[model samples]
Target chain A: MNRYLRQLKEGILDQNPTLVQLLGMCPTLATTTSLENAFGMGMAATAVLICSNVFISLLRKFIPRQVRIAAYIVIVSGFVTAVELLMRAYLYPLYQALGLFIPLIVVNCIILARAEAFASKNKVLPSAMDGLSMGLGFTFALCILGTVRELLGSGSLLGYRVLPESYPDMVVFLLPPGAFLTLGFVIAAVQKLRGMSEERRRRRSAAPADTAAGATAPVAADGAHSAGEADGAGRKED
Target chain B: MNPNQPQPASMPELLTVSPSPHARRGVTTSRLMIDVLIALAPAAVWGVAAFGPRAALVLLLSVASALLAEFLAEKLLRRPVTLRDGSAAVTGLLLGMNLSADVPLYIPVVGAVFAIAVVKQLFGGIGRNVMNPALAARVFLMLAWTGGMTRFSAPFAYLSSGVDAVASATPLASLKGGMLPDASLADLFLGRCAGCIGEVSVLLLLAGGVYLLVRRVISWQIPVSFLGTVALLTFVFPQGGADRLSFMAASLCSGGLVLGAVFMATDYVTSPVTGAGRLIYGCGCGLLVVFIRYFGGYPEGVSFAILIMNALVWYLDMLTRPRVYGKTRGRRGDRKGGGQA
Candidate 1:
C-alpha cells in the first residue's frame, strides 16, 4: 500500500509525465484548446496507457530484445485502436473533437516510455499501477491546461459558461501559440512551486541542527551557518 | 553578495574615485527612450488631433497601464524598480500608436500590460526581450480581437461628428483587393486616411525617422532597406494593372509600413547589431510584408513581417559576421590544406 501511494505521488506531482517529464507534448498542446477535448484526450490516452502497459508486461518474456520497440508499438497501437473505436461508438462528440490526435496516441511518448521503462521490467499488477499513476499525471496536466485554455479562450469550461457574457474571449488562447504560451507558463509555475517546497523541506531538516547547536554551541555560529545557508539558497535560484 | 565587505563612506570625494578618462557621454537607456519619445511626439500628436479625444484617451490609458504594469511586475519580481528609465513609457506609447483609437478602453490597457509584463519583463526586462514588445502586443491584440483591431474610423470623423462615427475599411484592405483606396496618394501620404492611430501619417513618421537618423539614435540601413524593398517590389509588379509609381507610393504609405519600418523594425534590442545584418533583416521584413500583403489572410502584414524578421536577427548577425583580422574567407580546414598545398 505504501509503495502504491509513493507511485501515485511520484506520478501526480513529483514526476508528472506531461508537466515534469514533458512527454506527449503533441496531444498536450493540440487537444488542450478546450476542457472537453482535453479531458477526452487525457482519458483516451490514459486508457491506452493502462491496457498497453498490462499487455506488454504479460508478453515481456516472449518479445525479443532486438524487436522490443517494434513489439511495443504494435501493442500500443492495438490499445489505441481499441480506445479510438470505443470513443467513436460511445463518445462520438469527443471522438470528432479530438480527431486525428486519438489515433496519434499510439505514438504518445508517455505510453511507449512507460511500456519500455516499467511494464517490460515489472509484473502485471505493478505495471498496471504504473500506468494508472502516469495516466493520472497526464490527465492532471492536460486538465489544468485545458481549464485555463477553455476559461480564457472561450470564456467557458466543460461546455458551460464560467465568465460573464460581456467578458472578451482571448481568441489567441484557442490558437497554437496560446497553447505553447500556456504550457510554458504552467511548467514555470510548477518548477517554482517545486523549488519552494524543496527549500522548505531543506529548512525543516536544518531546523533540528540549529536547535541542537543552540543548546550547546555559541549563538553566533548558528546564526552564521543559517546565513550561509540562506545565501546558498539565493544563489541556487540565480 | 559579499556581506563581509566594509561599507563605503558616504563622502562624495571617495565615491568619485575611479578609473581615469572619466568623461562620459550623457547617453543612457533613459536618454535614448526620451529621444524616441520626442521623435514619436509629432506623429502621436497628429494621431490625437486627427482621431480626436478618444484617441488621446487610448494613448493615455496605454501609457499609464504600461508604467503601472512595469512598476508592479518589478516589485512582484523583487527587482530594483527602474521606472525612471522611461522604456516602459516608450513601449506604452508605441503600443497605443499601433492600436486603432476607437477600440474599447480596456484593449489598450490589456495590450500595455501584456507588452510590459509578458513580452518585455517576463522575458528578462529591457534590452533582453526577443521581439519588439509593442509589436508583439499589437499582434496579440489583433489576434485576440480581430473585429476590434480591424475596425478603423476615418480621420477627424470624431471631431466633426459624434464619437460613434461609422468604421471604414483601411487602405490596405482595398489594396489587398487590388483596387486603389478612396483616398488619393497625397491623402495617404499626408495622414488623411482611415487607419491605426500612428500608422496613417506617413509624412510625420518620416520626419520622426529623419529626426532619429540625425540624432544617430537609429541607423538608416534598416528603414532605408525595408522601405526600398517594398517600393521596388510594388513598382515592378503593380497590382491590378495600377500605375507602377502610384502602386509603389500607395504600398509605401499604406497600413503600418512606414511606422514599422521607421520605429519597430529599428528596435535596438531585436534588430541586428551590424550594418549588413540590419540590411538583410530589413529586406526580409519588406519581402514578408509584400508577401503577406499579396498572399496572406491579413491585409496588413507590417506587424507579422517585422516579427518574423525579428526572430531571424541572430542568424542574420551570424551570417553577416565581420571577418577576423587575419583569417582567410574559407573554412579553417580548407585554409590549412590550401596553405600546405
Candidate 2:
C-alpha cells in the first residue's frame, strides 16, 4: 500500500508526463485546439495508458529481455485497439472529432516509457497506480492548455460564452503559428516558476546560518560569563 | 625639412584599419531600396491612369500605415527604430499595388500592421522573415476581409460613362467561376479591365519588370521559370481552343501574378539564394498557382503559392547545395573523408 502511494505521488507531481517528461506532444498540440476535443482525447489516452500499464506489469516475467520493446508495443497496441473500437461504437462523435489521433496514441512515448522504466519492474498494484496518476497529470495539463487556446481563439470556453460580445477574438490564435507560439511561451513560463521556487528554498536555508554565526562571534569575543549565557539561551531555543 | 619626408617629431599614431575589400561600392540600404522604388514608378503611374486617383489614395494609405505600424511595433517591442531600412516602405508600396483602389482605408491599415509587426519583425525583421512580408499580410487580410477583397468594382467614373461596367469579376475569378465571356487577347494586353491596382496593365507591369531585370536587382531565372511554367501548363491543358489566346493572356495578366513573379516571389528572405534552388522554387510556385486557380476555391493563388513555396525554400536549398571544390562526384565507402559514400 505504501509503495503504491509513493508511486502515485511520484507520477502525479514529481515526474508529470506532459510537463516534466515532455512526452506525447503531437496529440497535445492537435487535440488542444478545442476544449471539448481536448477533454475527449485526454480521457481516451488515459484509458489506454492505465490498461497497457497494468497488463505489461502482470506479464513482465514471461516477456524476453531482448524483444521486450516489441512485446511491450504489441500489448500497448492491443489496448489501444480496444479503446479505439469502443470509442467508435459508443462515442462515435468524439471518435470522429479525434479523427486520426486515436490510432496515433499507440505510438505515444509516455506509455512505452512508463512500461520500460517503471511498470515492467514494479508489481501490478503500484504499476496501476503509477499509470492512473500519470494519465491524470497528462489530462490536467492538456485541459489547461486547451482552456487557454479555446478561450483566446474563439472567445469561448468549453463551447460556453465566457467573454463579452465586445471583445475581439484574435483569429490567429487558432492557426498553426499560434499553436507554436502559445506552446513555447507556456513551457517557458513553467520553467521560470520552477526556477523561482528553487531560489526561495536556497534563501530560506541560508537565513538561519547567518543569524547563528552572528550570535557565536559576539559571545566568543566577550568574557566567559557572556559566552555561558549565550550558550544557555541557544541550547534552550534548540 | 624636405617636403617629401614625413614629419619626424610626431609620436606613434593610431591608424584605424579595416579588412581588404576596403574599396567599397557606394550602396546604402536606403539608396538601393529607393532605386527599386523608382523602378516601380512606371507601373504605379500606369495603374493610377487606368484606375484613377483612388488607386493613388490606396497607395498613400498603405505606405503611411505600414511605416506607422513599423514605428509603433519597434517602440512597443523596445527594438531600435528601423523605419529607415526602406524595406518597410517597399512592403507598403507592394501591398498598395496589390490592393484595389477602392478597398476600405482600414483594410490596408490592418494589412500594413500585419505585414510590419507580425510577419516582418516578429520573425526577426527585414531579411529574416520566412515568407514575403507584404504578401503574407495581404493574404491574412484577404482571408479576414473576404467581402471587401473580392468586391472589386471598376473605377466609379469608368462605370458612369455608360461603359457597360458591371460588377465584373477578374479574369481569374471569371475563369474559376466558369463565366468567362469571350475576352480578347488585345484587351487583356491593353489595361482596359477591372482588377487589382498594378495588375490590369500587363505591358506596363512588364516594362517595370524589364527595368528591374536590366538593373540586375533581381535574377531572370525565378520570373522566367515562374511565368514560363504557367504558360506551358495553360497551353497544354487549356479549357477551350477557341479562347486559347484570351486564356493565356488572362493567366498572365490577372491578379498579382506579374507583381508576384517580378517582385514578391523574388523576396530576398523567402527566396532561395542559390541559382538552382531559386529556379526550382519558382517552378513549384508556378505549378501551385495553376493548380489552385484551376481547381481550388480561390480566384487568385499567387500569394498562397508564394507563401507555400517559401516554406519549402530551406529544403530546396539543401537539395541543391553547391558542390564543394575538388570533391569527387561519387566515391564508395569514403567514410574517413568528408564526402558521403
Candidate 3:
C-alpha cells in the first residue's frame, strides 16, 4: 500500500506528465481552449491511459521484445476505440465537441511513454495507479489553462459569466498564438515556483545545522548563517 | 609615383585590410527602400488620377500616422526609433492603399497605430513580426469598425459634378451580396469602378508588380502561383459565366487580388523564405481566397487569406526545407541504418 501511494505521488506531483515532463502538448494546446472541452479530453485520455497501462503490464511476458512497441500501440488503440465508441453513445455533445481529437489519443506521447517506460515493467496494479495519477495531473493543468483562456477570451467560464459586463473580451486569447504565449508563461511560472521551494528547503536544512554550530562559536556564526540563508532565499524569490 | 614615394607601401598594404571577399558592392537597406519607393510611384500616380486628390491625402495621412506612432512607441519602450528602415513607410502606404478614400480619416489613424505600435513593435518590429503589419492592421480595423470599414462612399471632394456620391459596393462585395451590376472587363481593368483606392487599376498595379519583379525586390514564384491558382479555380467554377473571356477577366480583375497577389501576399516579412515554400504558401493563399469569396460571409478574402497563410508560413518552410549539402534523402527510421544490417 505504501509503495503504491509513493508511486501515485511520483506520477502526480513529483513527475507530473504535463507540468514536469512536458509531454503530450498537441492535445493540451488544441482542446484546452474551453473548460468543458478540457474536461472531456482529460477524462477520455485518462480512461485510455489507465486501461492500456494495466493490460500492457499484464501481457508484458507474452509480448515479444522486438514487436513490443507495435503491440503496445495496438493495445492502446483498442482501448481508445472503446472509449471513442462509449463517448459517441453516452456523451454525444462532448463527442461532437472533441471530434477528431479523441482518435488523436493514439498519438499522445504521454500514453505511449508511460506504457513503454513504466507499465511494461511494473505490476498491473502499480501501473494502473501511475496511469490514474498522471492522467489526473494532466487534467488539472488543462483545467487551469482552459479556465484562464475561456475567461479572458470570451468573458465566460463553463458557460457562466464571471467577468463584469464592462470588460472587453480579449479575442486573441482564444486564437492559436495565445496557446503558445499562455503555455510559455505557465511553464516559466512553474519554474519560478520550483526555484522558490528549493531555496526554502535549503534554508530549512541549514537552520538546524546553524543552531547546532552556534553552541561552539557562541553568536557570530549563528548571525552569519542566518544572513546567508536569508540572502539565498531573497535571490530565489526575485 | 606613390610606389616610389614610400618604397611605397605596396598596393595590398595601401588598401584597407578586411576579411576575405574584401570586394563589395553597395546595396544598403536605405537604397533598397528608395528603389521600392521609386517603383511604387507609377501605381501611386495612377491611384491619384483614378480617385482624385483624396487618394493622395489618405496615403500621406497613413504615412504620417505610422511614423508618429512608431516614434512614440519606440520612445516609450526605450528602443531606438527605426523609422529610417523604411518598413514603417511601406506598411503605411500598403494600409492606405487597402482603405477607401471616403473612410473616416481617424480610421486610418487607428489603423496606423495598430500597424506600427501593436503589430510591428510589440512583436519585436520589422523583420521580427510574424505576420504582415499592414494586413494585420487592416484586419484589426475591419473587425473593430466593420460598419465604418464597409461603407465605401465616394470621397466628397472628388465629386466632379454636383452628383450625390453613392455608397456603391465594391465588385467583390457585390458578387458576394448577389447584387453585381452589369460591369465590363474594360472597366475592371481601366479603374472605372468603386473599390479601394489602389486596387481599382489592375493595369497600373501590374505595372508596379512587373517593376518589382524586374528589380528583383520580390520573387515571381509567389505571385505567379497565387494568381494562377485563383484564375484556374475561378475558370473551372465561376458562378456567372456569360462567356469564357468575361468569366476569366472578372475573376482576375475583381476584388483585391491585384493588390494581394502582387503586393500584400508577397510581403517579405510574412511570406516563406525558400522557393518551394513560397510556391506552396501562394497556392494555399489562393485557395483560401477563392473559398472565402465563394462560400464564406466576407465578400473579399485577400486579407484573411494572406493572414491565414502567414500563420502557416513556418509549417510550409519546415515542409520545404532545402536538404543539407551532402545528405541523402531517406525515410525517418531508415536514416539510422536500420535496414543496412
Best by DockQ: 1
Q: What lDDT tens digits, residue by residue, belong to model 3 across residues A1-238? A: 8987887777766687886798998988888888898888999999999999999999999999999999999999999999999999999999998999999999899999999999999999989998998888788878877888888777899979899996656565677655654665566456555555655665666567856553444244444544443343223211
Q: Is candidate 2 or candidate 3 better by lDDT?
A: 3
Error of 1 at A64 (Å): 0.8
The DockQ value obtained for model 2 is 0.04
**Residues A1-238, model 1: lDDT tens digits:** 8999999899989999998898998999999999988888888988998999999999999999999999999999988898999999999989999999999998899999999899999999889999999999999999999999999999999989999999999999999888988887788777766756665665666567857553434344445554443343232212
Looking only at chain B, model 3 earns a TM-score of 0.87
Ordered by TM-score, highest first, the candidates read: 1, 2, 3
Which candidate ranks first by lDDT, i.e. highest? 1
Model 2 CAPRI rating: incorrect
- Alpha-carbon lDDT, every model: 0.89, 0.77, 0.79
Q: What are the runs in model 3 whose C-alpha is more than 4 Å off? A: A1-22, A47-96, A99-107, A123-129, A162-238, B1-26, B34-81, B99-133, B136-168, B175-198, B201-239, B265-341
Number of backbone collisions per candidate: 0, 0, 0
Q: Which regions of candidate 1 are displaced past 4 Å?
A: A210-238, B2-24, B329-341
Q: For each prediction, how big is the interface RMSD?
A: 7.1, 24.2, 16.2
Model-by-model DockQ, in order: 0.37, 0.04, 0.03
- Chain B TM-scores, listed for every candidate in order, come to 0.91, 0.86, 0.87
Candidate 3 chain A TM-score vs. reference chain A: 0.86
Chain A only: list TM-scores of all candidates: 0.88, 0.82, 0.86
Per residue, candidate 2 scores C-alpha lDDT tens digits across B1-341 of: 23433568987779867789877888677776886788778888877886777788888889999999889877865578988878899999989888987677777888888898777776656776777888988887676556677666664445367553346666776667654533455566666667778777777777777887787778898999999998888767776453665576668766678888988888778899899998999999999999998888888899999999999999998778776566644343234346552
**Better-scoring candidate (TM-score), 1 or 2:** 1
